[model samples]
Target: MASKVIKIAVPVVIIVLAVVASSALISMRKPPEKKEEQRQSVLVNAETIQTEDLVYKIRSQGTVKPRLETNLSSEVNGRIVEVADNFIEGGFFNEGDLLVRVEQSDYLTNVKAAQASLANAQAALEEEKARGRVAEEEWRSFTDGTAPELGLRRPQLASALATVRSAEAELERANRDLARTEIRAPYAGLVKSRNANLGQFITRGSSVGTIYGTDVAEIRLPLTDNDAGFIQLPDFANDSVKPDVTLTATVSGEVVQWPAKLVRTEGVLDERSRVIYAVAQVQDPYQRNSPDKTPLRFGRFVQAEILGDATTNVIVVPRYLLLAQQQVLVVDKDSQLQFRPVVLERSDERHAYVRSGFLDGDRLAVSAIANPLAGTVVRVSGDTDEQVADDAASEEATALTSQVKE
Candidate 1:
């Protein structure tokens, strides 16, 4: 019985050992499963490059002022007897309009006195002429043997005529002085302030008022040396060729754009600021009778922008593409990064104009990734060739529709 029990136990043990060995062998042959955290990276899509025209430009800021502004002053001394109806601050007037009048009684009296003096001189000359004529006749009679006696010389009559002429000139001068008592406007403009009041004493060269000519306003904009290179100035006489400039002033938190023109630019650069001054002209649309009331007062703070030279068929890319000031990264057909040196023509917040180092239809990688390698495989996202073709077709269709409508 013992021998039989031993034989069964031995077989059972051998079977268990074989099963364990087979399970261990299977486990060793199978490969390990990858962890969920592990991942393979892929390159993002790059921008499509194309050929286009580029323009270089520079930009700066400046202030707005009146094209013509002046402080009106009194030419003669007197009491301010009369003030113009539009003599107060912010008043409007036309050229040749009466602005102020000094007390004219004194000037008129002087003129009348001068006239009286001229009249008296004329009377005296007539008396002298009568006497001289008598004297001349006597002299002629003596020469002709009719009478013989000393007579007045002819030179005395000539002196009397000259005195009469001098008196006439004085009368004319007095009349002119009377007319100058009333001050008139030199140009059509708006009155900015009044310095003299009615019944106030005034002297020659005294401040009467301030005026600004609003027919055309001016704006001074500063430009860096780099920006001056691209601008093409219009002919002095060609008003229409000037760039359409604009100015904005934040009043009560609202911005208003005023139409302006490029009038001129200072030829020399400012040493202190390293900038060139450019002046622009703008028409004031705010005359008293004008439908618009955008008042362009002198010395008002304003922000200005000049619409500069424009180029057609140019490529405009984001400003971020610049690396190390003047360098850019370009991706070649082999998915390799090329450090290309480029000339930057203009850079605004939104775009940059490159003069070279790029061609039309070239792919550029805008998005960056860690450990980016040259000649690596990349997949395009956001934009694709099929999408581009579709866009082109859609654009063409739109153009056809527009033409048909037209």
Candidate 2:
């Protein structure tokens, strides 16, 4: 009986200790704490804006042409009797080189006739002068005063002078016509075509063929109003130093370039397209000045890039960074994206040249975002513009304070 009572009492004591421990644990626990909610910010890639002395360039396209193309004509009427081997199509000739000769028999006869007439007039004039001298001596013996005009044979002398003048004019014309029988090149050029053949009759002003001068090749490049601003074109009325240009064309699956000069712009704008045409010249296109000089063939289409005027304090950035309405998203000083409007001086395939709008040290945001808004919170990869400005100002202040202390 005593052992049973001790077992029951131990069980009761154990139950009481377990209940007390559970109450103490419950009292030790704390209440749940509330947390603050945070919004996610967009991340973007940005670049720092800087000033550069960049050489602006304008691009254009044009066709190469001869500086002067001539329609060769015969100056006198004659039958073609002789032809030069170099006078055929695609032939080259120097200035004053005879390319064709007409039968000279008829022209020679005319020249001789004119010469005989001139000789006769000269002889008559000499005879009249001799007679006047003799008559004047006789008149002077009778009157000791100025002899009468008729006694000095003045009328006969005047008539002879007139005849001489007429004959001389005829002789000059005859010689000129005879010389014209042989067609000679007026300038160094290549024959583009040949129309006259042996035994063919040709008259004055008759078209014989076509030829082009090879001294310099010209190209007319059309530029819009916008493109005109970038280049410094020479004046046609007053000569100026022409800006250098690079001309390129594709030949044999390779691109070749040549140095050209921007000569002048066609003064008048095109009535149809409203575009101004600028002329470019390439000297000695065929006859190279150097061993590596390649010929810019006539009629080949080519692209031209003219070095243009330079402007100070300009910014350059990638094209993707600029947004619609000439606006740009800039990462401002406060770790936020601010929409900015900028002035675009020009844009090419990959870059945009900025003339105005943003200050120096602007952080330009290049990455695109969804539903972007002004003053949007964003994270950037580089130092922000605000921080740079603050740092610079702080350094300036420190420098001033140092000088004061010294």
Candidate 3:
């Protein structure tokens, strides 16, 4: 009985030992699987910093106006006898071109009457002069006689001379009135509107028409005080300096761009808008004798871009790289995240010019992330180098395209 009991116990103990060894092997394999599961990956995107030319610009909405605009009016009162053939709206005319004509019959009659009056006065003056000569001779003859009763004196001759002068003045006035019957253009311009026509009665100082000089058009753009610095303007006396500015207008679904220049600036600030008014002069290229494309017209709306300071050797980054308005995320050589404060020298909708806190070859994270904390482990992925190169090429292409369009 003792031997049988011992055999059964020994088998049972052997089975238990086998089970324990298998459990130990399984435990050793589970650790490796758990370690693999515990590993974490951080998704991130990056861009490279590069040096290029950057332009600092100020953008504003502006309206086009004629450089020289005039409201033509009738200077003399009369019935309109003739209207200029080119008096229609948008009609171009040269300086001294006849714009309108008043009935000159009445003016001519007045002139003739003035001339007749002047002639009559001249005849009377001649008679008085002949009488004065005789009187002078008689006085000389009576030089020996001391005293004689003389009813009239030399003062009467002076009064007669004054009367002749007045008649001559009236004749000159009539000549001037005759010349004023025809309305002439003071400068070469386009007719904006006509208020008077042939056979229409017009009074002095009445609105007859409006004219705008075709030589140039002006655009007034408002600027903020912050934009006053860093922009270079052309010298006025330098005739060779062409205003290297351009304006774009969208008319009838077609985009048209024209050359322009920074003409002048309003010295005082506008109280209501708190902005400085800057004027840009655009040449009229559409004139009959113009050598290039038609210049911009008066009252046309356009987007104006005034050339500002072109910065060299600056790192221009996507505007989105700025976090919370003033902070940026930079990746170091060790692949660690760093929060850097930067000074934004200039900023636009697409790009930002950073004055400091970054260098060339530094990687900048452009894509926004969730809870970007210091010392957080992350797996930096995405086309950092390739993206930077592509972005630079794209930006250069866009700038070239804009220049060509302009």
Question: Which candidate ranks first by TM-score, i.e. highest?
Answer: 2
- Write one digit per residue (lDDT tens) for candidate 2, span 89-130: 878888899888988898899899999999999999999999
Badly placed stretches (over 4 Å) of model 3 are 1-35, 38-40, 53-57, 144-154, 233-243, 291-295, 359-361, 377-406
Q: Which ten residues in a row are the worst by lDDT in model 2?
A: 379-388
Candidate 2 pairs with clashing backbones: none
lDDT tens readout by residue for model 3, 1-406? 9999999999999999999999988888745343445765566777677768767665655878887888988777899988889999989899999989998888899889888988887787777777767776787776755433242345666666887888889889888888899989998888999899889999989999999888777788887776656556434554444335678888778898887788677667899989888778866635456656555667777886767877877778787777785878887666667787888777766777777887544578765778888666555676455667899999999999999999
Shift in Å, residue 230, candidate 3: 1.8
- Please identify which of the two predictions, 1 or 3, would achieve the higher TM-score against the true structure: 3
Q: What is the lDDT of residue 324 in candidate 3?
A: 84
Better of 1 and 2 by TM-score: 2
> Which candidate has the top score in lDDT?
2
Cα error, residue 158 of model 3, in Å, equals 3.0
Q: What's the TM-score of each model vs. the native? A: 0.72, 0.77, 0.76
Note the clash tally of each candidate. 8, 0, 4
Which clashing pairs does model 1 show? 49-361, 50-360, 50-361, 51-360, 52-313, 52-314, 53-313, 53-314
Name the lDDT value of residue 81 in candidate 3: 89
